[model samples]
Target: MEIRTGELSNPHVIKLLQTHHNDMLKHSPVESVHALDVSKLTHPNITFYSLWIDNNLAGVGALKALNTTHGEIKSMRTSSNYLRQGIAAKLLTHIVEQATLRGYKKLSLETGTAEAFLPAQNLYTQFGFKECEPFGDYEPDPYSLFMSKML
Candidate 1:
């Protein structure tokens, strides 16, 4: 699959992001859901990407700058049909590479701690991310888990 920068105007990408956000809400309480919508993903500090295979969207992810030397992984979602195909891993690798090239010393993320979120938690762990305390504007919340990796 080829991964490339994306814009909010793409309807398919927009729908996938909506699905992602909705899924997060179902898996976590509203107060714990941190998934960004299309509009928020367009912020200047965020770089969004779509992974396409045979011109069909396979997954999506983004990197948001937390500060000059730190960044956050956001909106990482692989289409349901693409699950277990390593698409998320590939997309994550690309994001990590971009962060390293940008001179980010670390990358972090926040995700749900519910049973529905176990797969994502495993994926992040397999990718070398380790559990950590909340970062950014987030506060301590039992329903949320934070992870970070050195870039």
Candidate 2:
């Protein structure tokens, strides 16, 4: 698979993001869905990437510079066709390596607390992320699960 920087103006990348948003809405409530939409993902602090396998979009993920020494994982989604193929794992590994290279001392993320998100939670756990209290603009919410890993 080829992972490359993505511009929000690209239609394929935009569509992948929209699909991810739709998937979140289907499996989580609006309030529990914290993923950045297309407009939000275009922010200067975020670097977006698209994973392509044989020219077909396979997945998408992003890293947001939360501060000088911290970063946040955002919008990790594997295409339905690519699910269970370790696509998410590869994307996550790429993001984490980039964060380390960028000098981030910590990497954090927020995901849904629902059972539908168990796979994601397990994936994060395998990468050494531990449950943590809310950070940044987030307040404690039962529907949200916050986690952080030291780089």
Best by TM-score: 1
For model 1, the superposed segments whose C-alpha errors exceed 4 Å read none
Q: In model 2, which residue pairs have backbone atoms overlapping below 3 Å? A: none
Best by lDDT: 1
Error of 2 at 76 (Å): 0.2
- Please provide, for model 2 over 1-151, each residue's C-alpha lDDT reduced to its tens digit, 9 standing for 90 to 100: 7999865787877888888888788877787789899889889999998888998888899999999899999999998888999999999999999999999999999999879899999999999999999988888888899999999
Candidate 2 Cα errors over 4 Å, as ranges: none
What tens digits encode model 1's per-residue C-alpha lDDT throughout 90-138? 9999999999999999999998999988989999999899999999999
Clashing pairs in 1: none
Listed in order, each prediction's TM-score against the native is 0.97, 0.95
